[model samples]
Target chain A: GELARAQPVSTPEVEAFLDTLKWDKNGLVVAIAQNVDTGAILMQGFANRDAISATIASRRATFFSRSRSQLWTKGETSHNFIHVQDISIDCDRDSIVYLGQPDGPTCHTGAETCYYTSVPMDEPKLLASTLYALEELIARRKTEEIAPGAKPSWTRRLQQDPKLLCSKIREEASELCQTVEASEGMERTVSEMADLLYHSMVLLSVQNVKLEEVTTELRKRFGQSGIEEKSKRPPKPTAG
Target chain B: GELARAQPVSTPEVEAFLDTLKWDKNGLVVAIAQNVDTGAILMQGFANRDAISATIASRRATFFSRSRSQLWTKGETSHNFIHVQDISIDCDRDSIVYLGQPDGPTCHTGAETCYYTSVPMDEPKLLASTLYALEELIARRKTEEIAPGAKPSWTRRLQQDPKLLCSKIREEASELCQTVEASEGMERTVSEMADLLYHSMVLLSVQNVKLEEVTTELRKRFGQSGIEEKSKRPPKPTAG
Candidate 1:
């Protein structure tokens, strides 16, 4: 999920950016391509300055194919084009990363990413934690203003009206409770809870509160007396 | 994201189910563990009758360790237990699948799933296609009478009150439109649209409309003139 900050740079700026990279003897740099929206590692390839230039110029991810011994414009044959969003380089400058939005699957095998194959849990933390993936996106959007054009995300907009967010949470929670208490609609309960989870994440995002904090509190109560744990909490203040 | 239907199975049933499995000469069967909630494959291991018995008895996934030459209760060392929900045998009965909810990461290497490494184009059809997953789940819930105990899904309940669902959709759509028109909040528009998407999915589910059908219609209009496409569709009935 790690990538570089992207900003539009001109021809000379692009050239200057490339000059900063420490290329290998093959005149290629290991490139990691990550999905722009989902924050998933879509694929990885190698790139030379020429390929980078073509990629920047064409706004498609272009790579120098080591096997083919030439510039390979991705999607040239597959048409699964990776529209380049930003290009970033590692601190060492030996490796480069391309952040892009793919029109289709990135893996030639039809997978979303090149590294879709689990490699003995080489990087377990990076596994697509599907349900909360959107939550993280919203969190990032709230914090980093990652989306270009100064676009405000839904998380940002909801932060403007905490009352609206809270009301939605309460409504969704009540609905979820009703569904569950009725026990006559498991799927509905799940669906209702999903809505609640989304709204709850929005609240957490707005408050800049991490999920792990709640998880930590939960963990603390794992073997302790619930009443004892609750006894230590700060007293609830009257509503302002 | 394939898994078994996880309903709390019983002892004799578990025994009968295990009996149906065709074990290897070493009395082993490959057991694949899957997350019941997200439908993500968690891990795979071998299990013998004892392991299965222990798993069923303890309500935790237990596996046979070939190298260790003994029964290995998952999360024994790591505390990342897979709380067994259901066990299903393959059609061939040579393999057993354990659908469970993990207390933590499933893979010893710290991954959510052992098969997290995706193989190249191994399964091309499932490269996300995100929007309709909920629709399919809702559809399944609506038709199959899933989640034993004869639960009428919230989708079903909402369908009974079509006007309520319609109003929710209309409210969400209007809010989404207002957010976009106001242009002061991009995130609000996204959140609003999310609400609309959820409501729309509910409508589709109740009507038993598959997302692919809608997609097919959209695809048909890809290159056609919008005005022409609109004209070709059946005329709308007059509003009541």
Candidate 2:
């Protein structure tokens, strides 16, 4: 039954699109799947022509498992499929992006995305992905049961006390403002801003809000600005 | 002069690290370069053993250019070299990360990163990377000269009027609080929070504060939490 579903589609449009791809010698191209809603890059893999065809036809992100040397539909067993809405090829034509919505955590480790681990540094540091990571960690702490006699985590305390969470947000916001008014250097401004972001994220988690929702809202505003700017530009020259 | 500097280091430590890598059939592995300070992933490319060696030895991000069939130092021509501070391999050992500081924008198109293009959507949308993108856009608008007779953009107005900027931040922050106090649904909460985040970023930009600094501060806090948690864990079992 699965094999039948995985069969490649050979429509004229599909064929035309596939023809433009610059597959490597191994007849594979790099394919990256991104969460359309959250904008999190879920995972990356290589896909052969069949995999691409299957992905488009099934609307499920499928990739060539280099180790297994066969096509693998992500979440086939886990049932956390990345249901692709649209696929776009990069300017290079050698890479493809499957903009999709994931049903559950995309990483096998149960993390939302695969790109969680940051490179080690001389001093402890976080990656840009830390925003998403913090969201996940805060969520985990919410449901996690404290060991018997173990102190409740700060996150737990904040989650339990709504007033505390809100107060922290306001307090952090004020500190952020102080940094600006005091003409604090970059370091202090960043520090205060970080505190505010962390506290805001805690409130979001307590309220059962996903960070993706916030990002999606931001994207909407950015797109509106882009549209406004585009309308002011002169019309493009049509192809001869 | 550059050639001498690109020589691969062949120390035992380097050799040991290289041996752990599971290179592809083409003797290459995916190498991602991230800005250590800002936590921005600057670019992704492939690297061989020699490329990795050269990167470690030179402390500059290096990659194997498949098209050119030779080692190439990023920013050799652009002078936007990513000065690597440390390198880390993923758990799979099939990929690597070079965490470094960028001298300037990393993309050839002058974008902060190459991952700016989002997949085409039925409705216009912004990617999660929009936060950094917005910062760049705001910064550009601050210095951009308005064309004669052209209207000043909203960003331009915000930049020119500090009072307006500060007021907006305060207003958005209050709205965000109202969402919580009034029991606003997820949609409204996310919308207000996004507005607050956007305004906060604008203020940070006006203050010449980089988003990376904020992320670094958050990372330091996360690390402190990690350290506290680790101290409580039972010691690992020793090898026989």
Candidate 3:
């Protein structure tokens, strides 16, 4: 039960640990909050000694706002708290990480994380979680209302016209297959595949399905070949 | 052809853009480098005016080393240069992002990115690119020579015993399927899936197969159903 609680802030051990930290000239250290379950970095900010102490005492992630020049606990306003489970300092002791469980979306923009924005490049790029990003964008588009006399975006048009969306999906998928059958170059193959993925994601969003559900289904099939083999084997004897 | 070259650094346009940046008290701003192709963040550091100018002029990602009190281009020593394609500033104008193509692994430790380590947690966790990380770890283990009398790791044992590895993969896959058949909770399903993914990754490493190859194959299958429908359609009229 004690392990479930935050480490006592008044302890001598914590005091010594804090003493070892190498704070910058402004008496602040870079602090990163990582989702304990997903291993995604939710956000990064600066923290002072008081902020760190407040985090430990309250079991909530707290940061020192540079402009405000004061400590503010995350989710104090949004109620999307990152519940700190543990705090760790980097090897160099100049930076810290708060391993925590977020109650809701951590970003102010309502994206999963603040680091979603990628540096602009000319070539098409795929983020590690591009599918997830696409899903989020599509979901946002689905919920957004169009104003009077406003033109509907391509995504909005797809969301409104179910038949058109379905046809587009089929069209993109067929194109993707043609790329493979024609022995098209890697770039064409990737481009077609991306189109298929995008259209498929939009369809999923229309159906109120999450991308995670699809990934989970794929994960299930990863072990499908072994199921038959497992069934053929004699069941292991269980002890009473 | 013009798109291949970096924007001229001496232009008044570049000067005006730089003027809008909100540098910190020390005349430094946060800089992040992202892989142009993969969309992975390579690393982050602080940059001064000189560092930004040097980066734009040289078409390389450069940062100000606070400890060294000088500007240094990434991969200057390692030769794994991040060739800048473009630079972008955040909406706040307080941070900069360099979109670049890296020559090799960006991290000094040989991992693809510096953001590999997830903050420690008691429960199991999975990163967005856990498979890639596992592949990298397995590859490292494959190459590293064991010190005299040092005990071999579990991964080393798997690498040494091909049959054992195969059996383990099958076993994990069966267990994963069992989680589904037995109506196990979501946690169990996710855990088993993670196990299967890990073992599969290890197998891929042993066989010299990359995870990207597997994903590409899956991408091909995303269009498989449409191939049949496309085959039934009449040929398009040839254009004059």
Which one wins on lDDT? 2
Q: TM-score, each model? A: 0.33, 0.65, 0.55
DockQ of 3: 0.11
Comparing 1 and 2 on lDDT, the stronger one: 2
- Of the true contacts between chains A and B, what fraction does model 3 have? 0.03
lDDT for residue B166 in candidate 3, whole number 0-100: 51
Of 1 and 3, the candidate ahead on lDDT is 3
Off by over 4 Å in 1: A1-10, A119-126, A130-195, A199-240, B1-191, B194-240
Interface RMSD of 3: 11.6
Model 3, B127-165: lDDT tens digits are: 333334345666776778989987565666666765555
Model 1 chain B poorest ten-residue lDDT run:
B119-128
For model 3, state the Cα shift of residue B160 in Å.
Answer: 10
Give the clashing pairs for model 1: A42-A113, A109-B121, A116-B118, A117-B117, A117-B118, A118-B117, A118-B118, A153-B187, A154-B187
Give the Cα error of residue B127 in candidate 1, in Å: 25
Model 1 chain A, TM-score vs. native: 0.52
What TM-score quantifies how close candidate 2 is to the native fold?
Answer: 0.65
**Model 1's interface RMSD:** 17.5
Question: Where does model 3 exceed 4 Å of error?
Answer: A1-13, A34-42, A53-60, A83-92, A97-101, A115-240, B1-8, B34-42, B53-59, B83-91, B97-203, B206-240
Give one digit per residue, the lDDT tens place, for model 2 in B1-240. 264336687888778878878898889988867666444456778999999998888888999989888888888888888887667665567777777778888888887766555443345433335566567777887789899998777777766776666666666666666667778877778877887787788778888987767765665567578423533544233211
Per-candidate interface DockQ score: 0.03, 0.19, 0.11
Candidate 2 residue-wise lDDT at A165: 66
